[model samples]
Target chain A: MTHFEPISPLSVLDPRDRGGPVQPLLTIQGLKKYFHSAGNSWFGAQSVVRAVDDISFVIHKGETLGVVGESGCGKSTTARLLMHLIKPDQGEIIFDGEKVGIDIPLTEFRRQVQMVFQDSYASLNPRLTIEDTISFGPRIHGMYESKARLISHDLLARVGLDPSRFAGRYPHELSGGQRQRINIARALAFNPRLLILDEAVSALDKSVEAQVLNLLQDLKEDFGLTYLFISHDLNVVRYMVDRVMVMYLGSIAEIGDGETVFSTPVHPYTKALLASMPSMDPDQPTREAPLSGDPPNPINPPSGCRFHPRCIMAEAACSQKRPALETTRHKKSMAACLLQNRDTPIPFPPIKVSGQ
Target chain B: MTPNQALETQPVIARSPGYWHGVIKRFSRNHVAMGALIVILGLILMAVFAAYIAPADPIKGSMLRRLKPIGTPGFPLGADELGRDMLSRLIYGARLSLLMGLSPVPIAFVIGSLLGITAGYVGGLTNSLIMRTIDVFYAFPSVLLAVALSGALGAGLTNALISITLVFIPPITRVAESVTTQVRGLDYIDAARASGASSYTIIRVHILGNVLGPIFVYATGLVSVSMILASGLSFLGLGVRPPDPEWGLMLNTLRTAIYTQPLVAALPGAMIFLTSIAFNIVADGLRGAMDVKS
Candidate 1:
């Protein structure tokens, strides 16, 4: 495997290398959200779109976990579910050692976890000024208006926008990148522990995207934040995330440290995804499509392994037997592929039931 | 990062006006809307100062001078079937006419926004319940429904207003609901929800401004329809009593003189047509001005 120097300097002191066992900041288990297709009559069983089906993953403390997938692969759905923007069909989300909605009330859980969405303008309340938008969370949580304003101005400056100039402006008055900076500032209003960035920088121009990514990196370290970064940009994922999770049809195909997953993908689906990244080098040109055909209709995904139909390494068994996430040869990663050869057979840990 | 730092040092651009300020500025630039607004405001001022503005008493009329032609010496607009000065009565009629035209709208706007926004923001069962109930009100034509409601309630200003208010609520509610639904799905609302904002707070701070503008514009369009409906009710004898100088009632009492003095007889109808048109064009202007994109 060709080793690429880690883009982020913080990767040198891996969270896994801490003295004790690495802590899981957020644990999701068996998360499912099925949307009922429109035009279904009220009487009978409706056609269900299984947006996120039985997905489980862990976001370790102070680490950025990038989730990548094609459109409708349920990356966005998973982000929404984690934030409880849309309630999951069946699942448990444990945040910072507390059961969300039970041990920690939803309101309290929300204060510790905030989200910055993909649409910079749509994600902001257009009617509110930048100051109002940033202070909105603090005011909602009962902080005095004056104090909230002060904190918002401070945050506005920290996000690299001059508070004096931008704080009074409305969303429409600002550019896409500036609006995103305001969104980031607002997310930090609660001093949130985890930030769910759902394609947060995808809409910006390439130059602005780099600046915003750097700002996010600085803010993540400064706030000691764990990020659930959802993006389809492989180059960005490699640069911004410490760990990478590859999703296909609402299931995790492979997950490992960014360098390992990018350089040596075990799952055929993950390999296809990495190869799909557009090459900048003139000497090495992509000769063929990495994966053929669009993802199967999510309404009735293929039985057993969701990726079996398109997976190049699929076997007869792959079509019949579902593959659970299992440890791969590399100690730092796991792959959910029937053909992945296992020697030590370190079984993947089962998700703990809610109460336990 | 370097570019962003440069952006920070750049002086602030000229401050953009607030949303409503922009709306008002756009509204002022529309000549047709401004003209309509002036006409409506003039009529309102005439109504407010009716006692001073009217040339002669609207109630006392001589039988000998009844059904006089337009441009009569004493009565500039002529005399109605009751020989009442047409201009004086029309001037005085503005009070009740504008009241009937304007009052029902705000009442319906408030009530409909509450119902529609509630049904929209709290979706599923609550949405189905409220919207389905509103659909029941839409089964009958608005005119027939208003007349029937006025007939059932007994004819009076209050009852007529109530009936007109009822006729407008369903359309306004439907508009409010759809707009609220649209705004509710916006990412900002989701962001607010994720920020631990209570549903009430989301509806108020985040959802209200977005949805209310469209709903208000829709309700303004309803005002013209309300005016015509109220006039129809009065013409049907289910609104203002005979002696009142309301435009609709005046039209009813003057129907007998249509053949003898058609010009005089058409004056009240003319007033109704003009006022409704004024209201409609102003509403169109508001819609244009408030088109968030512009």
Candidate 2:
């Protein structure tokens, strides 16, 4: 196996850092959102769409929790739910030890929690000057000093853009990467405690993505911020996040430390996702085949386990009973699969870690 | 690091002033729009200085000089049925016509934009109610609605202008609502909301900034419609009454002299066409210049 060098996590100690203890920044419990979709008139009754059915996770202070899944797996929806952009039918979102109930004055919540969207190109207002765009939040939140110009300039410099040079420009003037940096600058202007990056760097090219990822890592350290990083690319997630949560069909299939989850995936879905990553070496022998079929429709999901129909190691019990996410023999990891209960200990082939 | 060193490390082309200048330069290159802008400016100047430009008294007439052909010595564009200098009347007519055209547009724009922004950004029940009300007005043809409103309000210049302005509000509101709704869905708006921006702040800063440009462009296009409607109302004696020197009223006064000097009677009609087309061209140019897709 190729010895991939492990990158050290960036650390910048803030005055507030106690070094002894820290609390979880955000905790979501039993979050569920079912979208009601009208059925065909010819059919008997209307059906319900379980967009984000029973998903839960906790993001600690100064850490990034990466959620990885394919499209329509409710990853984006979950992020939106956390941001409270869309109201969830059922869920408990606790922030800084306070349970966020319905109508819980979003202004304060918004200041604490900010989200960076996927499409950087369409994310900005075309008509607004770059300075106005960045200063917008500060002005709205009343964060500016008497000299707003000086403060705005400082913020622009912090984001690696000169206020004098770039402030007056509009969105159309900047490139994809530059626009994304501006987006980040805008989010950070308010000094948010938690940043929800919803595929933030997905639109950029590889080189730009790498630069942005580095900037994010630096920002995280500098601010001591917690992040809920959402993405479909497992490698990028592995590189950026401290822990990983694998979601499949609106539910978490697995959750563990990033290193452990990548090195030894407990869930079959997570294993398949890892296998599907295009290998860096083209000449290497082909790995396992990509996922067989499309995800089951959210309007009417399959019974028992949602992934059972497509899972390779599925058994009779997997098709009959819904598996709950529980700790495996290694208590540090969690997986929702009946196979973990089997006494046979199915002899699965060993996964080759790239940086062994 | 020193401030200069930090500046040196920054991207070379990231200067804000230079970038904005580039956008402005690109917008300026549109020739048809520039020409239209010049025409509108000239009309505005002419309207503002209408009294000084007219050669003879607009309301005072010469029965002997009635129906005189244009370019006949002292009188240019000849005289109307009342024998008032057509040139003088045309110049003075610009004041009322431009006022009637431009004034109602902004009124409609302000009312429409507020309703539209609220409807679009709020969504749900509010959106439905406002949109349905706008839909009711939209069902009527604009000219018919103006005529109906004028008829209801009874035939005065102010009443006609009011009716025309009301007639214009539905479309402007519809445009504003649609544009705002689209803008509200953008990630920046969501980002603004996520940054603890109040609903008002998000709508004003993010949504309004994006939506207003297109709405203003559309409203500018409506100025011509307003001019025509104003003229039509005046022609029917339901707008500015006779002897007011309004363009539409002038056209109506000159109608009887069609057989004798067709050119003289057609002068006011030609002016209306030119001014309306000028406003339309300017609107079109602005739409093209402001459109990001273009």
Candidate 3:
């Protein structure tokens, strides 16, 4: 197996290199994933589901990048691609300074970067106990039984579930939130630099969600880890991530520093997402919430912009021009929208930089 | 090497007592299975100690005492047409009956499970090829297939064992492949892959444990069918040549005695029925215990 630089360039912590365009630890260049949808009947036809349609982004070292989108918007697909769980058809992912596909085996990449799934209960092997679940990767990767067990106990405690009480228990014995905590400990077992949470805490109650979020923050700081946090809850993303990327049907709609994107969303879909958050105001009207119609079948997306059909502020140009992500004035983040780049009837300021 | 990979390697912890204990507890709860298990175990011991258990030499016959009634002097279950001790022969028959019934199950289970798990995991072309081959075998009625195989192979103990083993492989493979396919798509399997476990390790540790339970229960159900088939082959004179104390062969030899000693003629058939029933009940109990839904 060829060696790529570790997913996190630990050497990049030099004091002299403090302030420049943050050299992203992981760079995903125009990744695309398409699934061939099989026909239902004997004589049926087949078509492609463009799951991750030529999307690209960077994950800065030690920063949590949140991915927010509707149910089928491909946020999880992007996470899967980054982890090498699924191969991307049309792009490359470069980690640290080395390109992943060129030198690294998928297994090697997995050691540096790991994932925690959405359904915590489903994610764990029911046949294995908390200790084995946490120690499985380390054992497979060649950790000693005693050492892995010791580390597992420490991690279990770190994740806020007492190791003595929980380590011997099986997955089914635990509550959803407890199982998710165990999931976090197991993901951490391999000492990955980047951890992808694909709606990890989404299955828990609100109270449980906050506690897990807090635990995650502590673990991140303690280990100096980077994260790809995917969720549908805009509020959770705002609280947990340093920057946020909002997707609309297999493409990025808007992305920026989390606070700025949440405050002033450049793309109409992002704006709609922010408005849709359940509000304290008793009189907040239905029209304010943007998501209504089911996502158009990905096998045959709309003419140009995939989100055009559901985009409330969409104009004739929106359906004709396939907007590419462009640099906004803030410079760190980008968005893809006709309104972001030209003078139109829309209230948002006209763009000087065109979305390619 | 990665740091985690560089660490001292160790084997996974052994399965805990609770795991097997739980399965045993669940199995024990099924009263019919428990009863069947006891009867089968007892029969197995009888087969193991057939020499000590049988009162007389099984094949030795006295022309002087032919067709004697049950509870006749010095013969607990009396004598058959050749005056062979019915009780001794039936006791001796347990060994052959069980050898035919029990032996083929494990052989089929191992072969069928390997084929099934392989086809299921590899999928697409491999799956279709193996499963279709099994389907062709399945197209023949199992009894006809066993009889044909035994006849073609030239009947005897080894031929009968081979026939019964071959007859079971197709359906067991079909069940194994389907269950394995279902398990391969489960989230935990994907999680294992993402954790960098090799394909072999994943299949062994993750997939095999889950699939084994269902495959075993199905294989257990095959035992009864195999025993009956073996006896059928012997009754047809294709298995155990005459003078062997096999249940079916004994039945074939005692056919003329039915009118004079009706109960004696029925003994071998009763043994076949009871053995098969014992297997069927145990299999049913195992199915209930292994079921994930319960």
Interface DockQ of each model? 0.55, 0.42, 0.30
Candidate 2 structure quality by residue, lDDT tens digits, A197-279 = 99999989999999999999888766667889999888899999898999999999999788888988778788878877877
Docking class of 2: acceptable
How does the DockQ of candidate 2 come out?
Answer: 0.42
RMSD of 3: 6.7
Please, what are the lDDT tens digits per residue for candidate 3 over residues A1-356? Answer: 21111223344453222233367778888899998865553556767898899888888888999999888889988988887777788898977756885766667778778888999987888778889888889899898888788888888878897666677777877899999998888888777878999999899999999999999998887766889999998888999999999987788988889988987777877776776787767795444334565778877889877777776567798899899998875676698986775555334322111222
DockQ leaderboard ranking:
1, 2, 3
True contacts kept of 1: 0.62
TM-score result, candidate 2:
0.88
Q: Mind giving the per-residue lDDT tens digits that candidate 2 earns over B1-294?
A: 997787768754354444335435656898877787788888889888888887888889878878888887788788778788888888889999998999999999999999999999898789989999999998988888988899999999899989998998899989999998888887878777777678877777677767888899899999999999999999988999877888888888788888998999888899899899988988887777666656
Residue A229's lDDT in candidate 3:
96
TM-score rank order: 1, 3, 2
Best by TM-score: 1
Q: Give the per-residue lDDT digits (tens) of candidate 1, residues B151-171.
A: 999989999999999988999
Flag the better candidate by lDDT, 1 or 3.
Answer: 1
Give model 3's docking category: acceptable
Q: Which prediction has the highest lDDT against the true structure?
A: 1
Pull out the clashing pairs in model 3: none
Local lDDT at B196 for model 3:
89
Residue A78 displacement in candidate 1 (angstroms): 0.8
Q: What stretches of model 2 exceed 4 Å from their correct place? A: A1-23, A36-47, A101-106, A127-131, A145-159, A162-164, A283-289, A344-356, B1-15, B18-28, B291-294
